[model samples]
Target: MEKRYASIVFRHLTADRLAIRYPGLRSVPFVLATPMHGRMVITAANALAAAEGVIQGMVVADAKVCLPKLVVMNEPPGLAQRLLRALGLWCIRYTPVVAVDPPDGLLLDISGCAHLWGGERSYLKEIVTRLRGKGYDTRMAIAGTIGTAWAVARFGKASPIIANGTEVEALRPLPPAALRLDPDTADRLIRLGLRSVGSFMDMPPAVLRRRFGGGLPARLRQALGQEAEYIAPLRPAPPYDERLPCLDPIRTAAGIELAIGRLLDTLCARLAGEGKGLRKAVLRCHRVDGKTVQVTINTSRPSASVPHLLRLFQLQLPRIEPALGIELFVLEAPTVEDTAPVQEALWAGNPGLEDTALAELLDRLKSRSGTRAIRRYLPAEHHWPERSIKEATTIAERPATAWTTDKPRPARLLATPEPVEVTAPIPDYPPMLFRYKGEVHLIAKADGPERIEREWWMESGEHRDYYCVEDQHGKRYWLFRSGHYREGEPQHWFLHGFFA
Candidate 1:
């Protein structure tokens, strides 16, 4: 089979939309500012800005003076990564093997898949059309090798430029930069009157190797398809996936639930076959009206049992409002784990208590309340009572061993720290009386002051002396006074937490 691949490169990807969207700013100067070494670094400049003598790595302050109307926007690294990932997913419609080529590009190995969408030309056109529909300006090129495709996508025109057999003739007219040579190499080639790829190709292989070193010759040959270039296709992630393409669209909740049950079975079977279990599964209902509704369920532990998966799905069934009828159902496992097979005890009838069952109940509670309303407590590496407890999403996997046996920890922790007004004869002694939550509480009994020194490195630095005190009302409170008596300022008292 003829190996076919595409290199889709988005031009000026780092530059923000202010340059492209604003008609008034189209001809005007604009620069994308990136912070480097405590100063704003100009990363990209438009043609008009360049004409005015602004270059990359120039200070933003100077660029502003050069062009008064120059618009500046902070370059977001996170947004750029998201755009690249979304584009990579969009390319999946063309070929299953899509690898993200960082910063702003994607490599797709469409090999035996091109015929499904007609030929290479049709596939490329469709890919461009879909991208354009989604408001992405893209440049695509298909070639015999990755190097050729990369060069052509950057330097070659929008026209389909295929390098079948006459690779040299095809690349001859292109500049030396088309071979992706370094700036110094390209400049040297231009100085030597070897400006075009054709000129470089005419030179003896041994002389080129001697002049440019071994890499240049190899790169040139690879670009020309004289040397075989191997492409490492991105292996698709193992999917706890189940799909149902209904001949008749499903409108009712019952119908949707029935389809969901079938999908759960298939998904469970696949997970079992792979010796894996899903922690979370997302049911994407592809509506006839083009919109998709996603219902997600999180399990406490890795599980592939049908009953457990169905129960979780049942909790979310009412939430699925099938507006125009769902044409297709796709259940995809976003998170999964390797679940060890349970060995049932000979005497025991059932396999203990299923964590999935508990997870389903929690999921129901989460749906009724808010997802944020449900949380799990995780132990933190701190002796301070307020900083010791951390809240995490119940869906998130936690370590098996969360607490350390060596540390002294309180049995109960308050969700929010209470405030206490204390009057002590000295900083060393515990408070005799204190006001908490606007109520007076007399400290009948008290414990030692556990001094915790301030972490100087952290922004929130505090030196606290904690005391476990029991009030006359029979409630125990953890109180602390910040700073020492020797320090100039008066000690500030705070009820850090509560004790069970």
Candidate 2:
């Protein structure tokens, strides 16, 4: 099959992305600018801003002079490249061969996949329509060659998929820039009356090479499909995936279990050989009637234990309907982590709560209560009590620094501290009595005024003086006062949390 390529040009990718987040800007004139020297220079502009005479590289001041109501935003660095990369990754759903053309375009090798989406026209239409629905202004073109597709998408009078062997004719009317030439060379060509590609395309290769260097000829050949242009396609992840196609459709629980066992056997063997394990795996069952049913399992640790993983997926088996019988089964481990080899006991040993067993238990808990229900926390070295503990992404991650345990901490910590009214005998002394949650409590005992300074790097004017106090009812509470007291100024207090 001839290699067919598609190019998607995002007319104003940066501005459109910003407009989606702030929908009011979609219909209004706005420009994303960068501070060049002392002046704001337009980096990108919306359709409305472009219509109002604001173009990229123009000074914001000049643009404002022309359109006084133009809204200007300081463009965030890498916003364009990041959004472009995300869009390129999103295109992988259509074709595995997707490459990002930096700043504002994506190249997709739709060679053998056009038939799946009807044809080249239908495929291009579906892609463009979906992107427009997501608030992106997109123009696309499909052709037998990558260069032709790129040129047609960008500079063609009207975007059309060029037929095979007609690239030279189709590219003749476009300017020399469509051939991807250097600005100076293109300007020289224009000055010499060789403005359109056809003016100099048929000239002697040696003559063009002598005037414009080798780049111009190479590009022209690439666009004409005379030279192979190799585009490095982005590799899709989930390198650890296994599929099982049943000769006979399976509907019974036993058959599904058997199929799952086979998949797990293959997947685990592969992971074990690679010395890596899965943190998350999803099982997709394609039904005979063209429906899909899926179940997912997650392990707290990277584990390649087959029985343990099979059990985790088993707990989720009931969730899969398989309404019309499953015809194909695909198990994909999208999330994986490298795990160290398990050390075996030299002699007789307990082997109690080992890696495999612990992983199985965590997986079971996750299956029953859902993934978010289970959480792991580790100590972080910090003087601030709240910052002393942090959530651990995985149980295997160890603390790099020692944890601060010099001071006593509350048994229960509030998500956010609540305000409380307090009465104190002295400005520096702990509170004598406090009113909290519409109830008054007499402070029978007090422990601390552990002052924690604010991290000025993050934010200023944020400090707290914490105190652990026991009330007359024997309920202990962690309290804090914001800032120091002034002789005539009012004081601020808050009930942070409770102690056991």
Candidate 3:
């Protein structure tokens, strides 16, 4: 597709901003000045002030002589760039690719976006009208390339929209400064009788480079579309993303749901075609009141199912507060993974981790309750009880080692063991009674004191002698004693887990 760009030049950015903040200053002649070399010098002049003999870089005292009533206000450092940045962000409603051209300009990549607003004429008209309504004096132009657009917006007096293949014609009438050359290079070109771009545009590259250095020739190529020029957007577009712009504000839940459904359908179709699925997706809502609210959903497995993902997002709809109304909806899938096609079974059977229904159910449950509400563990290749299990990374991940069923294991295992006081008849005997959490339980039936040694390579730690004890109430507990009894040191007992 052919690329198109738009440029906006603020005629009186600094003076216009001051007038915006103080409406009383709109009809008055004023100039924004700053301290320079120990003397206050004019940095910007409004239209009224410029009509007089007042101009930028003139001393405040000198400007006052031209217009005695001229209002001179202090120009804060970097204020113009700051205002341009904020204005660029607000322009995102028009195009997603908005870049701030420093000092007093903005560039927008409106390649295919203009058609949405009816046409390039209507699109540019809407933006310029809106900015002018907000008290900013702006000149806008659109062209097939950024260089030509920028040059025409600032210098050309013809039409705002430049046709494709006419970049050289459009740039020929403009001055050499329109190519964004440094002040010194532009002055050199002017002194050498190259007043307009057309004068030296067709000159030999080697001659231009030898006379004026490489900057002039490089910028010339860019403006003529011979070389590519790219802009650094304020917000980079995400890889897997979809956008929906509403004609009117969407205040009702049904409107939000409709927007989300449309976005998901388009996004899932793209993902399915690429044999990829999204694991995490975010829905960002741009509101009319200049606020953004978002909802995020994550799946246990990569999924391209629109219905399943839509249901998951529906559970989080209440969390979004549509104050005033939402104007734009953006859906982004930041995490995506390649998915393999699964064969459908003719008859109903156990699908286990491969069950799409189960995965969808888990995703819904997590969205409703919380991410930490559910977890899956797999057997690990280790002898230590603490190291015997590991959390599964993916839903379909398989364990490398099989679970040992020869010994009795607890249904609920504690992450860390807690100390407990116990009374035993002998050093190797089971606990007759134990006190845990200040509750004394008398042991009714007790099993053997099974010894499990700690893995020395991992760390040097005392081995545990585990025991399965049943209290008076038939509640079973797993208890362990650290190391063998010594002559002076006391034995430490801990309650490790419990059985159902």
- The global C-alpha lDDT for each of the candidates, from Candidate 1 onward, is 0.74, 0.86, 0.91
Pitting candidate 1 against candidate 2, the one with the higher TM-score is: 2
- Name the regions of candidate 3 deviating beyond 4 angstroms: 11-86, 238-240, 270-276, 334-339, 342-350, 425-428, 451-463, 472-474
lDDT of 1 by residue, 203-242 (tens): 8889999998787788888887778876554546344566
- Candidate ordering by TM-score (highest first): 3, 2, 1
> How high is each candidate's TM-score?
0.53, 0.55, 0.84
**Candidate 2 total steric clashes:** 0
Give per-residue lDDT, candidate 2, residue 312: 85
Per-residue lDDT over 319-372 for candidate 3, one digit per residue giving the tens place of the 0 to 100 score: 889999999999999999998776546423556877778888899999998988
Of 2 and 3, the candidate ahead on lDDT is 3
Please say which candidate is ahead in TM-score: 1 or 3.
3
Per-candidate clash tally: 0, 0, 0
Question: Which pairs clash in model 3?
Answer: none
